[model samples]
Target: MEIYRDSKLILEINDKDVNLQVFNEKISMPEFNNVCKLNPRVKITDFIALKKLLNLDSTEKTKIGELKEIYELDISKDEMVAYLKIYLTNSEIDRDVDKVKTDIISFLNSKNILEGINHELLNSDIPSCKKFVVATGKAPISGENAKLVYYKLSERKVKEGTDGNMDFYDVKLIDNVEKDDWIGEKIPPTLGINGKTLFGKIVEPKPGKDAQLKYEKKSVYENPENGNYVLRAKFAGAVKFDGKKIGVDNHLVIHGDVDYSTGNVDFDGYVTIKGTVADLFSVEATKDITIEGKMGIGAVKFIKSRDGSVSISGGVNGKNTTKISAKRDVYLKYVNETSVVAGGDIHISQYSMDSYLEGKKIILSPKNGRIIGGQVKADHKIITGSIGNKFEKKTVVNVKGFERVMIKHELDSIEIILKETIGKANKLKRQLEIFESNKSRLEEKALNTFRALIINYDNIMDEIARTNIKLDHLEDMLKTRGDGEIKIVNGVYPKTVLEIKNLQRKVNDLMSCSFYVKDNELHLYD
Candidate 1:
């Protein structure tokens, strides 16, 4: 430390401590000549000396007392500031005008000011607050209250009892009130991350640790304009942040663009897409999603929920589901879902028999697209956009591009041809003789296969006969009608009838031409 006459620090140091190889001999007290820039590490002697110099009780007055006497000193009752003179000489109470105001209001309230006042934003275009008990200007106040009231009212409401402009509003100029004795005011609470001040209690965030509150989450104490009021976050270790951390459980907003390409993001929280989510990403969350920008080109969007799913605007062929199945709704611009239920009403815009739809009730959009597959079962109602169907229930379909769907038979010729192909393919030893050339059982097996083939052929012949009878009936009906139009029901198109008949006839003809085979028979069914 140093002391100066004209302009220099009157330096003082323990001679022994000052000169030593291990001491590093590197220390300067800015208070030298009335200037003391701080060093992070204060030597033990410095700490005691400085404390004594600034403490409420100092024995042999230090230069600080001399400095205060030489320079007009108006240090507020801030022990912290007194502890370090650097700030005391530079900053003034006027700089904390809002704090002064809050102290006065709080003091007035505790002391029972004429009337109670609700604190709000200090600069609002329209008054966000009003004095219902007394007309404006009736209470003892000044121009600042007039100017500050406007803001208090215009700013949005904060958690139950916090002021807007600052933890405390400016009180340096309030008439008939003490600036330092507000009912619940204390030294302006220490401002930390997000400018949050703390000094009382801790609250469990709604979503628990890291839960982001949509609104200001702190609870404030509002008292009648009287005693001191102070706001402080007592917990020193709690991490405070800036801007807003959004999420169902916890949300985050990146000021810059985000590039996320994880296999899946599963959270028991809410997610927000401020920038484009470039690819089809999967997310499983307990709550909802809000997409601020369009999902980039060529990406599919899918959301999974355990409770309920909500998307501000969404997509097609893409499905969003939730385990809470009931009361879940999917709103989209252009999309398809077999079922949607809101308050128990299920709605389907377009659906195919092959595509399954199951719900408590359904409402179909007036618009309808082609449906090639699945079952539609709803307990309530079904609406339609436009009915496009082949009128046949075709399974295993993707109903994508082909307009005017039709029932295309999926032939499983394996079962039908199995018996015939295998039997005709079996080995034969009949020419040698039943007893000498072949084993008795093997001969029987061959004859049995051939006989079964004959029966199968006969069955085809019968089918042909039946088909002809039907054809004749159709012809007779056409003749009977003599000019009326034919009605097709259940997709029994004329072509379908023709296909069956043609296939049946061919089978009959093939059966008519018998054949015998040797070893290595084909077991088509197996």
Candidate 2:
């Protein structure tokens, strides 16, 4: 029989179950409760089911006061988490909260979910009618792979100096290693830790992989200073790394030109090139470098030695594009439009035309070796066939060499700068004088302009004073040191500038002569 009837819903109670039918989709809870309030025997044991049926156009039945059927427990597929859902109950039903909590705990314990359980949720006043995360498991972490650390050379192709010149000699294509130098060290991998699950099962973490250290056993040795895996060089050589292996190369020989096929030659030890070095290709070494083949009318990029000498059997036609630097002497057959810097003497079999040469002493074949249209500097003496050509091509010979020439150039640059600075200061001073009487009557922009002129003039004056002091110092240095001599075996033509210390004399008439400094005077003798 129907106990409560409304326009949208009907509720009936029987011995087996309580039935509910929702005629309308929108039904109120107060309407159902009003019917229950009139009959004390009718009670809501499952408020969740009754509330769900009130908003649906269907019929559903549920047992009164059946607490066990209202609970739901679920475990995720991975078993890493567990969820518990409890349906709503009514105050009118006789029930025990602790008994329900005890049943849930017992059920979780039966499933072996003791680890990572949320105890606070089980002990607190848990809100019903919704699912809650009751337990969580930890995830396994991955270990980092092993790595190698070692000394690495700079990868920059050109290093710029403070003087705004590119230092090609400083670039190292191969990393140079000394005896007992550290090559690299292999760091061991870490052992991974195990994880846990909601069921107290062990989850293994991923282990790191070890990387193999490949090297030549004869050229490299394991260091025993500490209990670490470190490799060191057995002798001095260049470091060679070929993706899978590493070793030290003492002597390297190139059978062909240093072109696209060979790239660049950079070795720690001696290097010998059987053929010519192609244009835009560089060869650098710590020891001596020898180029046996003739340079085939092309410019060589650069050739450098850190602690040894350089020798080119074939002549070099650099075309103003080549540079050779060596710590010791340099021997060349003939050079044109090239720049050579040597710590010791430079010996040339033929002539050097339109090339920059700097060394302790520059010597050429006295019979026919000529220097034309270029700057040549030597600290000791310059022995050449001729100073300049008969056509009066400009050729500058500095007997006092590198330091003196650099100082003179710096001083000349400073003089030009001083002249410009003084001129600007004078112009600004005149502009400031014009605005002196009308300072207060000027506009904001005009006043700013007047103030800027005064500041710029003061700054220029300060710069001029500093430059004068520097000029005095350089002039003193130039006067005290100019003792080298120049011996021209052939003839010194016009447009040839001879510099001894700081004194410069221009050659006008063609004359075979030798110039020397005595008693602060440059004397020329035939």
Candidate 3:
């Protein structure tokens, strides 16, 4: 019988006699004869030596049936699958199909690769001369995160005209939104798919994160039909979206001049005029008013909020016909031939010419602060660099006198009415007391007269009480007088009049001094 051990040749006779054992690459004739001697019943033709059958030389180390399995196995960290690699050291060696398949199966099972196993490479003929991959694994697909997509109306830009002429009407100053206008849409996150490993293990992918929309409740709301957020304009005006929050403001913006083309604007909210307010046109706002350009000739602008302010980047060059009023502070680049009023402080960056300006406090820039031919009134202080021009133009600076005069006049009127009411009440009370003492059960005419007298007395007393309250209020206002001052930084030229409270003084020369009311007299500090 013939036997193979480690791909070497072995000859056995019956069950007990062992003759030849050849492990070397080459075998001599003596070795072959010895193998025949050991197995007398076995014909040499029936059993052939491994080295002789493969025709190998003595220097070679591998035989035809003695090839060792040389292969590599790699498993991914994600447990997606395993890869099988096979190589051959000798290209002449015939590969064992069953052994290669079994070895590859054992390797994959060792690495716990139990699912998605490709059996085509295992069942097909594998080349021994080159290396090849046998198996592959699948990876999971990731999902996208949620995002917000804004509508067109929320970010509309100004359209330029192609007519070759610069038209201010082509610019869109404000982004307007109507009620139930689509503002933005929210895209929801998607769920990730599950993946399988080469080792039959499950791999779960991370899901995308979700995002919520933020907006003002009164100005925007989420639509139930499409799950999109839309703008709900509480008032017809401008719309704003700050990436996070969406809001709508009650305002009207004019892109062009307020003229016959665009009628006078009367908005309940803020008003922003990008162009000039034309002559004889009026722009009024219940809130704030912002004029980006200069006020045209004879134009009028007003703001009504005591807390809201007005800003005119371009000065009011109204030629004595432009009138501007602000309930709060007024900010201007310059004022010329205009009348301006503010409840709070007024800041003028440049000179004022022939303007009547009134506020709680008026300040002009010291660099170009010239109040020439203007009557400036402030409750507290009036600060300017030059009071009059080089030609000694007539300029008047009055401080803390308007409110005092008005309050005093009101107080006087209330006192006179109060005195008359008291006199009338005393007269009616005396008449009523005399009538009541005259009779207990008087005639109808007398009773009616007595009741009338009592009514008149009570009415007069109420009137006196109301008048006293008014008088007390006015008196308190008069007592709290501001320490008003006229601060002249550079100088006050001749013919410039300075008034502090009730006292007035004319500067006859180039005087650099601060004037204030002291002891009912205008005092000057140089």
- Candidate with top lDDT is 2
Order of the predicted models by TM-score, top scorer first? 3, 2, 1
TM-score of 3: 0.41
lDDT of 1: 0.29
Worst 10 residues of 1 by lDDT: 144-153
- Candidates' C-alpha lDDT: 0.29, 0.74, 0.65
Instruction: Give the TM-score of each candidate.
Output: 0.25, 0.40, 0.41
Clashing pairs in 3: 80-197, 80-198, 81-198, 113-199, 114-199
Question: Model 1 compared with the native: what TM-score?
Answer: 0.25
After superposition, candidate 1 runs with Cα above 4 Å error: 1-249, 252-263, 274-280, 291-302, 312-314, 318-327, 336-355, 367-372, 390-526
Q: How many angstroms is residue 310 displaced in model 1 relative to the true structure, after the best TM-score fit?
A: 2.8
Q: Provide the lDDT at 350 for model 1.
A: 32
Cα lDDT of model 2 by residue, 79-160, tens digit: 8889977654434122576776777778788878887878787777665646898787776776665676655644523343
lDDT of model 3 at position 495: 90
Q: Over 4 Å off in model 3, which ranges?
A: 1-217, 220-248, 294-307, 401-482, 518-521
lDDT of 1 by residue, 295-390 (tens): 321234444444443332322343322111223443322334323233232332233333344443333433232333443433322333222234
lDDT of 1 at 357: 45
Better of 1 and 2 by lDDT: 2
After superposition, the stretches of candidate 2 with alpha carbons farther than 4 Å from their true spots are 1-71, 89-107, 118-128, 167-176, 222-228, 242-244, 251-526
